[model samples]
Target: MKRSFGLAFALFVCTFTFAQQALWGGTSIVSPEIHENNTVTFRLKAPKAVKVQVTGDFLPTQKIKTPFGDFDGPGAADLIEKDGTWEYTTPQPLKPELYSYTFLVDGLKMNDPNNVYMIRDVVSVTNVFIIGGGRADLYKVNKVPHGTVSRVWYNSPTLGMDRRLTVYTPAGYETSGKNYPVFYLLHGMGGDEEAWIALGRTAQILDNLIAQGKAKPMIVVMTNGNASQEAAPGESSLGFVSPNMQLPKTMEGSFEMAFPDVVKFIDKNYRTIKRKQARAIAGLSMGGFHSMHISKQFPDMFNYVGLFSAAIMPDNNVKSPVYADLEGKLKAQFAQNPALYWIAIGKTDFLYKANEDFRKLMDDKGYKYMYYETDEGHIWKNWRIYLTEFSPLLFK
Candidate 1:
């Protein structure tokens, strides 16, 4: 009887493991199948569900009224049911870019059963796919000499915390036996050390650009600009914490004051050039604000400065040395004659006016800078474009 029972249990486990149905109550069907023409087909095999809809960025989106602000709410389309499968294909070929979507089974949002690639931004998670050919190709992994990404810990004397950072060293840095320039890349508000690697595809872009000789092989240091957080959610001793936009100590001069500590840690540990000429700093949104202030406050520390859709000024009530002496610091920064001071913003960005005013200040002071204007608003897509365009101009 014991042997018979054991055999039955083994059969049960095998049946559960090797099933034709998806683990989530549906027949397995391939999703996000990209064609040579860049058109995409999404499928769901949920016959039990009354309705299934697909919502993605590839579809048209509208600005919906919200308490916080106006947010892009992409329209959803019902999938046609053929036999047991619910399927939908794009009306037109999708552009070469990363697209995300999810199946709304009877109003319940869920990821694709067949597609495993997903990305989590702050809290929301969605399945993602890439149609490669153009700029999206840079966001995809190519057959090239890749870089090394390390989640390193460093002590921050300014913030009085042990901070975690993501560092990307070039393909041959370990055995190259040569020092290289370092680019300090900062993320936007609500982003952590993992932002650029996941959202911006920094490693893949750096590897491809360096292989094509478009960008210099350098170390990219991505730091957690959120001063209060020790690391990303679930990454530190804090355990799992829900990410929120309400963060303190941001742009309060604490990060700028302790900025040297990050530099010191990198210089001491990495094989960096260790000089003003070989150093560069850039960030998007909040990080852009930090980069602008940090580079100006420490004028001689960085040779390249980029501000992508930066918040040029802080709230009136907040006080800090980092925001003070704006004209004086600009003069001092330009007096040093840095290699590249790039300011890029999208035409539709909410910060476009602020950047325009900042540009006027630069013009009024005769502060030379390379300005780039793009289409779209203050979003990750624009920031990624700014990164690819900005990095090649560094360490030249």
Candidate 2:
């Protein structure tokens, strides 16, 4: 009788283990069977699938015409039907960030009903996946001690309008009485303060970096790149201007005048080390253009200027005679208290050459700057990595 009872107990344990499924918002769903290399493998029990395709915006939206094979290690996707079920894999190893994907069935876009992790993009949902890699680590949201992201509304006397900015305070900020340096980090076109909060993952990235002793603890301020009042969020008729250096075209609101006022407001509200050496400004793409513009415009404001894949090629309008030639301005900016100027770009980025060209201009002008290049392109993957590489060196 005792032996029989033990056998029944063991059977019950096995049943529970086999019946377990990944829970999504409380309901059990398909759990991806992840491989050692972090490749996800799953089988959809759709026996009647005429044709199945896994679609992701990560790669070019062009449909994957053939079965995903070993294009790279543990990378590739395959669509095979066996025993009334369809199985698919990725065509190449995914980047080390969360990817939004959907399965295309007969021209219909559908999410994997079995996958637990999903987010709504408009009316449809996309399945999310995390690729494995050290550079893309910030994309994966983990439950670490997070920093504070606050949306600040201020009266911008400089721009003559009430402007908004996003500020990220690192952990231990609340209790730590010691003030920290400020890093004025800006975003590119089609982005605002929320860009760094979301796509850049600045808070999480900084959290992990500071925790891992890889980066210094500092406050990050993300501001709107557009200088026009019409460019605020949805105020403009043209949704987002992708123009290169036609900068002041979007700078209609006199962002140049209002910028110093924003700095004053930051000094008032935040416990910042309000000195030149304690202040740094940097940006990407359009933001990079602004950083170059603003840092030169207000030579005494910042001690460091970082241009991540900057699009700075002295434009025709802002040419030598117009807004003060590049050489004289850079000289004055670096003359009194030139901060550490750091620039980085991806090897495949469209802005790669632009960055190099800007570097040459800086060299020709005798401006000191640092240049870094990576393997990725003009995407979030490269920007996040750039943040990791650039942040630690600030406020040193």
Candidate 3:
């Protein structure tokens, strides 16, 4: 009887150990699983974690009205934890767009390990997934002839550094043996040269547009607008710093004075059309400001100019010598009879008033320009849409 009891106890211990091990191990987890209905389901395996939550751009932002002003409130959903796994499904179907998300496990923010696809913006890194079709399909990698995107370092005597820039050469660029027109694309305040390629989905847009014959096949040069930085973060010895770091006075120095060097380098290296009519310049936010100033500074250099939600500070308010003769500069630029001078902004943008004031100034000066308005506020969605609309209008 004693031997039988001992054997029974051993059997119980073996069974209990097997059950505990099974709880911690299982098949691989598939996160951000997209359903046919456009709903998304996210899952994470954190058996030991006490709490788990998920937040993403797809989730609606909670707005808080404080005495100071209205601001974005925190909106995160707690995940259901069961059997060593956490999961959450969106209550509503997500719209057709590329959405980024992150997981918060016990208050620690992390990217989804199971989702290999990720995107790095100027400040944060997050995993990304796309849903549905239509406009979202334009941002995807379709079966079409693609372009080549390269990060090239060039001499910038004005900035006194070897700066880096992103260049895009269209399909058949090498074997076609044709000199293509050039587009100088600039990024926003916090963005680097990689911004357009990573977040803007520039290559995909250009490829699809060119394949459809909606836009001319052209070379795109994406320059680092930060006058103080020698290169994008991680590519330079300066090391990576927060995007909100206090910029040096030189950081705000004249990009117009230094832009000629960029043009000179591209002309010397690439098979460019080498004329104002074949050159275009465009940017978003601070880049829009740069586009305005740079085109004004060099009137004969660019025939097409696009300002995407430009941060247009009035000449009277600016202290830089670059804007000292703003009126004369703009007059000279407009006198050149450029092909297209386009400006676009969202109606609810914080800079709406500033843009309105700028447009009034343009009207007062009798300068000709094309204006476009959208439905949203200052955001990447508008910028991408602006790019899609603007590219087809260039070098026609």
Best candidate, TM-score: 1
**Best-fitting candidate, measured by lDDT?**
1
For candidate 2, the per-residue lDDT at 369 reads 76
lDDT of 1 by residue, 97-216 (tens): 777788899999999868878987777778989888888889888899899999999999878889999999999999999999999999887889998999889999999999999999
Candidate with more favorable, higher TM-score: 1 or 3: 1
Question: How many angstroms is residue 199 displaced in model 3 relative to the true structure, after the best TM-score fit?
Answer: 0.6
Q: Can you give the TM-score per candidate against the true fold? A: 0.92, 0.74, 0.86
Minimum summed lDDT over a 10-residue window in model 1 is located at 19-28
Give the Å shift of residue 29 in candidate 2: 4.6
- Residue 251's lDDT within candidate 2 is 35
Candidate 3 lDDT tens digits, 114-169: 88899887777889887848778778899999999999999999889899999999
Q: Which residue runs of candidate 3 sit more than 4 Å off their true CA positions?
A: 1-27, 48-51, 62-74, 239-245, 249-251, 314-318
Q: TM-score of predicted model 3?
A: 0.86
